[model samples]
Target: MPTPDATRFTVLDLLDLNLNEQNALNLRCIGGRKGLSREITVPDLNRPGLALSGFYESFAWQRLQIFGRGENAYLKMLAESSNVEIYDKLFSYPIPCCIFTHNLAPSKEFFDAAERGDCPILQTDLSSSEFSSRVLRVLLDIFAPQTTIHGVLVEVYGIGILLTGDSGVGKSETALELIERGHRLVADDVVDIRCVNGSVLMGQGANKVIGHHMEIRGLGIINITHLFGVGAIRDKKQIQLVCGLEEWDANKVYDRIGTEEMTTEILGVHIPKLEIPVKPGRNIPIIIETAAMNERLKKMGYHSAKEFNQNVLRWLESENARALYFNRDDFL
Candidate 1:
């Protein structure tokens, strides 16, 4: 099942007094102006506070006064003072603002000061590294969700297959074979994939009939559309399958039957998958085409292995019946 889009909680969203109290066991947001309090609080790993001019001048100076001249305590004092000063500056910037804090809890003094027009406080359950990763991913997904990549995509026997592997993995070779078999080629060499409607993955070729050409190591590049005619190309295809080519490992046990289904995940959607081991004399293109046909058969409710096994069992039962219930004298 597709997971819901990662819910992003801003400083303002989490700052609600009611929601804060509800999830208080997990998170605690305190202080900030009550009436004008919906301030933006995002978890930013970039030390926005450190960049502020004179951040060390105000809070750092106060902490030194409170603790006096203790040289060993300076590091602890500096960290705490910087966090406070950062929060102070973030609150004054804009409503929807965020700053990151680590390890140390906000002191009562800081929270009390924040209550008097200070910024919203956000606590994260993730470790420093983990929180940074999650925050960056959410930000990237929300702000920039699309990217273009160069690859090949094909549709065989009604199943859309995307072929991707190392530079010399024969992706284009296999696509060419499928096209020769009368199946349409969707995209070749450079396929553009986009996640539209959050669930469906649509793939198309680049400009200049990217779906109409194929490249071979010895032959260089050949145009399938011109040679094989217009029936050889497709405008676009839904990505129903993904085949990742990897160097075959002798020690690794690979799936040999279709009883279990394997899937490849793209943009959080799981598409049917198959691992075709590569080796000298192996007809990988034929294997992929057969796999697509098999998938189509499965969709039509026909299973060759299951049917053959059932027939074998029935034949054995007939032999047993002859041994158990038949009489030689009756036949005579």
Candidate 2:
């Protein structure tokens, strides 16, 4: 699925991405300005070596084409041999763009063909391997299935816990307590979640400007980063657990024993879920903290509730065995 608020992801969107230094693409367009608006539909990439060699049997013309030094060298050979027909044949399909790695430049003839085909040609300074890896990673993140959720995302005890509930269910208040108690807040109110690699859900604030800002019931708005320093806020985190906060009910039965596991689905991926009932003197923040630690223990192969149940079962069996021995005919 596409992100709730985003439109088509074009080549211009990739260029406009504000990535950090380590993951920056450093791409610049050298030709075909009118085709920069072309949409990139796929997450995968193609090297275009086979297409350049006139073997277009299994050509992946829809993906972003990465032309390494070898492909450029072949193109140079083609230019020398006046084999210009292959360029037109290659651009015949609506390829997203042609990316030249290692600061490689295309010949005048190739640029003419790209202009004629209305295909954008991009250039990068990194080597073929490095650029390919970086661009692929970026593309995967962009094309990943995404959706926006109404909740607060926080990191407590090194686990991402999504606090969800009705509008007036004290979800934000509980998250505020969590933040004040030395935990880190990923986002407040609106969380943009993306399912990366089809398994892991990465969550971040919907808007960067107001991501760190939180709106309490009466406090209006407060900046978490400024109030708690930079250590109390993070840009993003994986959604490992979901805890739904609800008003405490007098008649509804709650799960006292944790033998059975519960889960909730988001973006078609399931994660551990807990429904927490809130009332006065409930100490929800501490409970959430403990829940985070318990989740970690579960990941480490320790099940507290299950172990306790097994111990109780063993004790009952021992008691029954003792009663049988004492009441046996031979013993009596």
Clashes of each: 7, 0
* Winner by TM-score: 2
TM-score of 2: 0.94
lDDT of 2 by residue, 61-148 (tens): 9999999999999999999999999999998999999999999998999999999999999999999899888888988898888898
The regions of model 2 sitting more than 4 angstroms off are 1-5, 325-332
The alpha-carbon deviation from the true structure for residue 241 of candidate 2, after best TM-score superposition, in angstroms, is: 1.1
Worst-scoring 10-residue span by lDDT in model 2 = 1-10
lDDT of 2 at 136: 86
TM-scores for candidates 1 onward, in order: 0.48, 0.94
Candidate 1 residue lDDT tens string, 1-332: 01122343344443332322323313344345352334223333343333333454332211101111131134246455654564355345433322233433545544554565444545545344554555554433333334344567888888888887888877777778778888888787777666655777777776553447778899988888888889888877888778776568899888875666788777777788877777778888888888888878877998766777788899998877776668645544
Model 1, residue 184: C-alpha shift (Å): 1.7
Best by lDDT: 2
